[model samples]
Target chain A: MNYFSSDFKLGILGGGQLGKMLLAETRKFDIQTYVLDPSDEAPCKIACNHFVQGSLMDFETVYNFGKQVDVLTFEIELVNLEALEKLENEGKKVYPSPKTLKLIQNKGIQKEFYIQNNIPTAPFEKFESLENLKSKIQNLKLPFIWKCTEFGYDGTGVKVVRAISDLENLPNVECIAEEMIAFKNELAVIVVRNVSGEVKTYPVVEMEFHPEANQVEYVICPARIDDKIAQKAQEIALQVSKKFNHVGLLAVEMFQTQNDEILVNEVAPRPHNSGHHTIEASYTSQFENHLRATLNLPLGNCDSKVAGIMVNLVGEENFSGPVVYENIEKIMAINGVTPHIYGKKETRPFRKMGHVTIVNEDMKIARKIAEEVKNSIRVISTK
Target chain B: MNYFSSDFKLGILGGGQLGKMLLAETRKFDIQTYVLDPSDEAPCKIACNHFVQGSLMDFETVYNFGKQVDVLTFEIELVNLEALEKLENEGKKVYPSPKTLKLIQNKGIQKEFYIQNNIPTAPFEKFESLENLKSKIQNLKLPFIWKCTEFGYDGTGVKVVRAISDLENLPNVECIAEEMIAFKNELAVIVVRNVSGEVKTYPVVEMEFHPEANQVEYVICPARIDDKIAQKAQEIALQVSKKFNHVGLLAVEMFQTQNDEILVNEVAPRPHNSGHHTIEASYTSQFENHLRATLNLPLGNCDSKVAGIMVNLVGEENFSGPVVYENIEKIMAINGVTPHIYGKKETRPFRKMGHVTIVNEDMKIARKIAEEVKNSIRVISTK
Candidate 1:
């Protein structure tokens, strides 16, 4: 299909930062895009050719939006599966098909699928309800990880249980009790696949979590590790993607145990934060590759020109309202520092306002600059 | 001032492809932007926060738009100088100040300024009209390059006159007759300077023009020339920017004569086509650097990560109307090939509709792929 400057329309389900970045690639190719997002002030509102404000979880809204475009994809995974299934039956293309999403949406089912596929993962047990887990509390590991079966995002819907009393305050929901593995590091590899089944995997990236927030603070490319370990992580990620039969980008989060065993933790079937540094450092950005994958175009070169580190510009504690990026100019002075503000008009505590990417031919210099950037810039509120 | 996610407004004149590319940087920084263009269907219309449809050459329109912005810059050089001067006098920050533009808007004045500043340039004489040129034909060199003093853009308003009869059909307007120098190569260097006086120069790029159209067909970075010649070109470009006291990007085009001496051909005081390859090859793209310079932010690294060659995508002859990029997919299959389609709906013969960038660690490989891309893709109208 002649998508460039043609009548072909691509429908995107989310209009947040990922969608905004994806639109940049679409704009670059002059591909027509229609975005359906719930917010009136979505960052993607301006770049897309068409904007429809509607909840992605609503069946009718998603189905209507899908019907208008030749191909449909989502930046976020919390979309209406029924609508996607219906669209597929009606002959529309929905990447990361409903079946793939169904198998991965719930934590319980995802764990089950990983085991069935013989993928290495932490041991876990699925509970229909929190009550069932409470009734058998002593039989389970004391310091296990408890995660809700569905609707878990970011660091939410998750908790670490230490004692029986900890379970008392937890919400009653379908959940999983996972044995906590003492991993040495968290790593991720983004695998991209086109409709033709041609696949490519980005180099493994290490995620450094904030001590208090339990959220990713830095995504360092070419994760500082042995080459053998990196290769293992990539192979596992490829294995996961092939098993899922996923389309577009699939970012596999893995845990490197003390013995260097790589175990699957979770996966996000879209552009992941771990791959954001690709925009400045790689031959082809993950966002651009995602678009190419969805369009069934040949995958681009996925090699990095330099080592890159990403620093998330989350809102500071106790700051809310109109956003301000303090000391942005200071970081801009540093070589190879590129800040990407998501065009979010407002900010609250812990809200992701933007990110800064630092790249250098020397990884040490890039990391030092990343630290300087982290120390200089602050996401604050004007009011 | 907090530019990112703040209320600081950046006003840009002429929403053509340059403005569209600039908007990509603005969006990256989350800097609020207002764009003015005569056409409602301009490429910048959708990407900017607020887009005003108005002639960039109208004093009232430009002034009104300037009033609403804290800082004003332009992608096109043909904007009303009177309005910019008025805005600057009223304390509005305008990069590449009106005074600098005044010296550039007319070829006669630009040539005089270069000569007065001791800048190397081809010798030239000003003419009040074609009749005046005809009257003094005997005194002028036999084969001189005649160019209209004002409003000459791209390859238009330029002619090679070898005889008195060549002036018969020329327009009756102020013009300049320049001594034609025998040049072996056409080169360009982009110099960027921030308001704080921090200046940097991109590597020299060589332009290969179409034999007939006299328009640039490919822009090859690193110039494929001796390091000494490249250094000389960069030094001259920097000198030109400093002499003009220019802020933002100043692209200096030059002619390398048979003796290897560099002479100034002309200059564009904004992002130029010659530097478009920097978007994929350099550590910092010209558009991003232009924004940083305009905003008084510290400059980024000017080094290139890989060699890049850009092929301009012009509309095919005998085809005009709604445009289609035929075989774009076929080209995408080639490694390191990226197509950037300017969202222009209509096409005319030799009109620039887009460009393709081919990048590779090896320059020879990049050039080879560029030729393959040029042969595979066709920019033609479907209707």
Candidate 2:
């Protein structure tokens, strides 16, 4: 299709940071885009061709938004699936079809699909509710990972149960108890597939956690791991993409067990945080690749020109109001440092405000600078 | 100054493709921008925070717009200078001060400034009008270059006087006759200076011309020349920047004569086409550095991560209607090929619709693919 500077319109659901980055690509290509977001202050409001302030989960809202565009896709997955399904049934193009989303939306179903397809994963048992799992506590292990089956995002619905009392205040919702494996590292591979079945995989990235906070502090590309392990991670991610038959980007999060075996952890069927560094490091950024995949254009090369590292700029604790990126100028002075601030007016503790990417020919130098960036900048509020 | 996600406003004049690209950096940093352009369908209308439709040369329009912004800059040089001077007089920040622009806004003044500064340049004589030059044609060289002193852009006011007949239909305006020099190559260097006097220079770029059209075909970064010659070009460019005392980016176009001596050709005090490849090849893009310099922030690393080549996407001679990028997909299939389409709906002969940037580790490979891209895509119309 004549998408470049043509009359074609692309509809995007969820006008958050991901959508904001995608809009940069769309603007680069001169492709018209319409964004549907609930927040009036969404980061994407200024860049998109047309922005419709509405609920992404409301059936009518999503349906009407989808009807006005030639092709429909989404940045967030919590959209009204029925609206997309209905739109697809009526001959509208919906990438990563609603059917694929169905299998990946619910944690229990996603894990079960992996097991059914002979995909290696941590063993898990599904419970109808948290209470049901508690009733069988005597038969379960001392400590396990408890996850809600649906509507969990960004560490919200997952918990580690070290004692029975840990489950007392938990919501009585559908849940799963998975046997936790002692993993040495958490890795991610972003797999992109076009509608024509052309596929490519980005290099594996390792997520390094803070010793005290237990939160991811850095995402290092090329994973400082053995070549064999990186290959294994990429191979499993490609397998997941094929099995789901998904169109667009599929970011597969995995674990490297103590014995070096790879296990599937989860997958996000869109541009994920793991690939944010691609904006400055890779030949084609993940956001651009996702747009190409959804539009069925030829995919771009997913190779990196230099080693890259990304650090998230979350709001610091004890401050919550209008946002201020302190010491941003200092980081800007550093070599290969680029900050991307999401235009959110307010910031709460641990809330994602932005991210910084550091890239260099030398991986060691890039890592060292990333640490300096982490120490130099703080996201706080004006109070 | 709390520029990131704050109330700091940056006002930009001329909302064209350059402004559009600058908006990408502003969006990345969450800096508020206000753009003023004459066209309602300007490329930057969608990306800027506030877009005002008004003549850039209108005194009242520019003055009013400048009053609302904390810092003001321009992408195009044809702005109302008196308004900017007024703003600067009132303690407002106007980058590339109006004084520097006065020396550049006219061709004769720029050439005289070069000579006065002891900068090497071609011999030239300024005329009050074309009729006056014709009266003294007997004393001038037979085949000299004639250029209008003011209001000329993009090859519009420049011509070669191979014979007396070639000046028959020339415009009756102040002009300059320059002794043509035998040059081995055309080169450019971008120098960035902040308000606080910090300065940095990008690597010299070589502009290769088409053998037949005599128009630049490719802009190759890290010009494949002797290290000494590149250094000479960079030093000359820095000298020009220091002389101008200009804030923001100054793109100095130069010539490497047959004797290997560099001569100043011209300079642009904003983001220029020669540096577009920096967006993908450099550690920090020219757009980002221009924004940083204007904001008085520290400059970014002016180093390249990979070799880059840029090819302008101009309209075919025979097409003039709604534009269509024919075979754009074919070029996109090539590795490291990225086409940036300016959002100009209509296609006229020789109109700059967009540009394609090819980047790779190997310069030879990048040049080869740039040729493939130039041959594959045709900027035609859907008449």
**Per-prediction share of native contacts kept:** 0.88, 0.91
Q: Tell me the TM-score that candidate 1 gets on chain A alone.
A: 0.98
Clashing pairs in 1: none
| Model 1, TM vs. native | 0.98
Per-residue CA lDDT of model 1 for B1-383, tens digit only, reads 77887789999998999999999999888889999999988999878989999999999999999999999999999999999999999999999899999999998999999999999999999999988988888899889999999998877788888877888887999999999888989999999999999999999999998865567999999899889999999999988998999999999999999999999999999999999999999999999999999999899888898899999999888999998888888888887888999999888888999999999999999999999998888888868
DockQ of each: 0.83, 0.91
Tell me the tens digit of each residue's lDDT in model 2 across B291-360: 9999999999999999999999888898999999999988989999999998999999778889999999
lDDT per model, in order?
0.92, 0.93
The i-RMS of every model, in angstroms, reads 1.1, 0.6
DockQ of 1: 0.83
A276-306 per-residue lDDT for model 2 (tens digits): 9999999999999999999999999999999
Residue A53 lDDT in candidate 1: 100
Residue A119, candidate 2: C-alpha displacement in angstroms: 0.8
TM-score of chain B of 2: 0.98
For all predictions, the C-alpha RMSD in Å is 1.3, 1.2
